[model samples]
Target: MQSKVTTTKEKYPDKPITFIVPFGAGGAMDLVARILEKSAVKHLGQPLVIINKPGSAGTLGWNELVTSAPDGYTIGISASELFLHPLYGTSRYNYPTALEPLAQISSTPVIMVVKADQPWQNATDLIAYAKEHPGELKFGHSGVGSIPHVVGETFSKSANITLSQVPFRSAAEAVTALLGEHIQIVFINPGTVKEYVKSGMLKTLAVADANHLVDPVFANALTFKEQGLELFYGNQFGVVAPKEMPADIRARLITGLDAMINDPDFKKDIEAMGLQYEYLDTKQMQTQWIFENKKLTNAVQESGVVELIKSQKQ
Candidate 1:
């Protein structure tokens, strides 16, 4: 049998590797990619270059990765929204079977959050109060088909509430809207705003993980299950390469990734950044990716996002 990875490694023993990031700088995805940049260099023996191709909700980079030569040299950082974006954007790119997973780094629970100064004390209070008010409660998201919007919608439908949903352009903008009291609740990454929670600016009501939110600050909050609701979901982040890459090369890449995730220093870096570190190497990543792909489909069907994208197609 031919040694694909060995051949590629021998051919370009010192060539720098490229890691494509399909999101804007300063965003959570970008931050995680940059962190990996610091730790991945030693493993690859050459410098790691990150390319930002933020458009079509991360489909542009996915498209680029699919078309690029799969010699184990090029890979992309794929995240939650990318799995669902093409279904909402008029993009011609998507989960082409051409992409292969190297590993999954971590998972973050979508937390229903409100300003610390807000009147609602927990998810129960928020849901109950909204039941009476209906459409009076407002929430913010990155946009119409964003994860936050979908989470809020699912939460509302499951909780039997009608909170209004608002869309923003970026997480920073969403945070501003939340801080200015423009929206009553927001679904946000737990890591991005941990400081705000620590500083008492944002109060987390519930985490859409299980029936509980483990953080001490949220110990008093009520989860959907506790409130007699049945909805739970969040986001994940991982690395992927083209499926055509030789199996040997793919294995080496995943092995290196597994080592990275287990590195104490790397684990500390992600934790310090307020992001959770959940490793799902090769097999697990493949399973998780497939599951989330179905979710994106279901979300599109329920949200009419795929139809919206089709209508916008030129």
Candidate 2:
């Protein structure tokens, strides 16, 4: 019988791999995909060609990915939207079951921020002010069902406060609202707010991670855990192929991704982009997908976010 390694070699031989990014070019996920392509080709012996398919909050690209041939030639960069979108009834594919987990590439925490002139100084103060004026303070997020939306909802539930939610087309737009004082707060990626924070236009209330981010701009910010909330929310980027991919091909892809994720240069480049290089093998990635889906489903159901999201879509 031919070994798995030999089988993968025979399958690919020299055909270039098609990599799909479920987002537009120049996003963090796209950058990660491109960074890995540089080193992954060296290990897999096939160049990775990136194709961006952005729309419907990444569901369009995900549909393209799961519907593609499961020959290991087409793979996509999966994000938190993989789980959130399905729960919101926006995606047709049941992500955890439809996609074969190859490997987890990177993860980044959501940083909650407010304009520098806001009265609240920390999460505790923010929660207090929110509780005292429930449904009065408004927060902005990238979209109705995005990670930031879920994080804001989860935070409100944990603190027993009700803050109005406003969804925008992107994080940059949400930040603009915050800067204009149109919103009291916003949850955004650390990298997006780093410049504003540096210019003293915004102040970070807390990061939704167990520990503060390592980036100098957010290194001093406290975490939700430190503030006595067991809240952690962030975006995870990974690679996935159709569920029926050949075992040998899946193994080969996982091996190449693992090697690229662990490379020193890869780590530096990812961190520079305000993303942490954390590698999870196939098994771990599968477990994470299941766990995250359950958590997100519960949060959306309990918070009535699903109804809110559906209303927004109409």
Candidate 3:
């Protein structure tokens, strides 16, 4: 049943609100959720309950949130790319109409990386090499439906190479695999690989953006597009609720989210991740979600990963 209290001020006046984080503790999504939890609770005069549901590249827990009641009692922090998972390949569930977009919390690049001493000097060199040896190149990602996983798929379809995809549990795990030479390449958040690039532990091949990430790593690293590739852009994350929620309730949630988006603390935190405060309202989110779903479907059809994504459903 819908909560009798429709406003954030009204509904959350007496009790805590639960925010489901689709990744494990201490990861990027988790970190953002924790901070926002503090700010949101203070703003709303209620506690924000953060529950971590980590598995299946974040799909496992996200599915849980989507299936929850449409009342404003439950909310979720999830990545934008997850909407692409089922279309990209296969999964047990879909991002249901029960969920609505509260806001896009922040955006980050899915960057391509390699061992510091790899033979390739730039993305072009890597592409040339991969073209010559398709499927021989190995790349790592957090999991089959992760941003990194889709990023790899996007790059391969654009470049027409058969780079093998390896899925790990976290960005740290994928980076460690790269360091240990267990994998030759992987797409990761800049923060996850920044220390390694500084210490000569890894090399940044290209960022999914048209330009390079200049903060933790300088912009000269090179872009995949500059290498004559056809793809650009990567994943971002957001806050969402059930789709059929009342207008007033949606406004209340967005109000809370907008306050946090404009707050100094949230800005600083996102900047530290090499991310910008690019928030999307429900309409923008829906439109983009549809567009991305199409791209993912095409990619999956081309890459032959539909069955793989299907088997990963938890």
Candidate 4:
């Protein structure tokens, strides 16, 4: 009897691809997804549907992505919290085994800002006040385990000050509280506060980055490192799929996304939105995921945020 031969054929993305944004509409993640949808659809030969599942510090959408079938039709725009969530004990699945990276889209560094009339002029003055009045200064962040929260905690550890934390539903909300004088400080992306900074409603004390930002709005602001605090923080956005996706399908998705990242119109839109356009292939993104996972794990542990989170829950 002759044995039957078998061959695996590739059929992918015949229908609309669902791109999950783990945040509400009008946020950075949502904006990124909407901006790329047209170009990505054109490149992939299918419509890219954006589904917002905002909650659990961005893990809700990630959970949706990981739980979906590994068919390359369902993917998500993930942020740094995807890795930090598991460290904070908020997620059941970890990054390494739960998701597969497709491409890194962009990154926006966090900026430390205060109300325009606040007394502190720069990072030095703020740190000095915080050091002298530990537990008196209130800093606002989007959520407990969000990148801005981690940035605040990291600043506390690096600067040796004990500042109080105030969590809001989103960065915009936190900035609103800051504007109302409900909070003394807020760590947020420049884009969210760009108009306010330009309008003189907010003062950017320093950026939590290693290098100076290219955005003209922050040209005069110094980095936290420049201010003598060895600290850096930012939000990195990327695409991820369910683990064990077919190799050919993953390659197709990556190719389409890579093209979208390099498109002139897409780049212009991202810059206009005050985001830095940076692209990383699948391999590079995987390396970044691992490196960031380790780096943030240490930061979270050392900052004692894990304990703080547990206490808050209690």
Candidate 4: 10-residue stretch with minimal lDDT = 1-10
Q: Write the per-residue lDDT of candidate 2 for residues 1-314, one digit (tens) a residue.
A: 56986765566636888999876665566777888888866778788899987667677888999999888789889888788887777789887789887889787889899999989889999999888887899999776778888788878878888888997765777888899989999987776677788889999999999988988878899999999988788888888888887766777777777887888888888787777677898889989888888877886788787887787788
lDDT of 3 by residue, 198-218 (tens): 778788878777766657554
Give per-model TM-scores.
0.83, 0.82, 0.83, 0.90
Extract clashing residue pairs from model 1.
none
Candidate 2's C-alpha runs over 4 A off are: 1-15, 117-119, 125-138, 157-162, 176-184, 195-201, 228-230
The lDDT values for all models are: 0.73, 0.83, 0.72, 0.83
TM-score, cand. 3: 0.83
139 Cα displacement, candidate 1 (Å): 1.9
Q: What overall lDDT, based on C-alpha atoms, would model 1 receive against the true structure?
A: 0.73
For model 2, what is the alpha-carbon lDDT of residue 279? 82
lDDT string, candidate 4, 1-314, tens digits: 12321122144567888998877776677888898896866788788999988776777778888899887789888788887888767787896569888888888898999999999988899989988887889999877788988888878877888888998766777888999999999988787787888889998999988888887878789999889988778888888899987778888888888888889998888877777888888899889888988888887788787777767756
Q: Enumerate residue pairs that collide in model 2.
A: none
Off by over 4 Å in 4: 1-11, 131-134
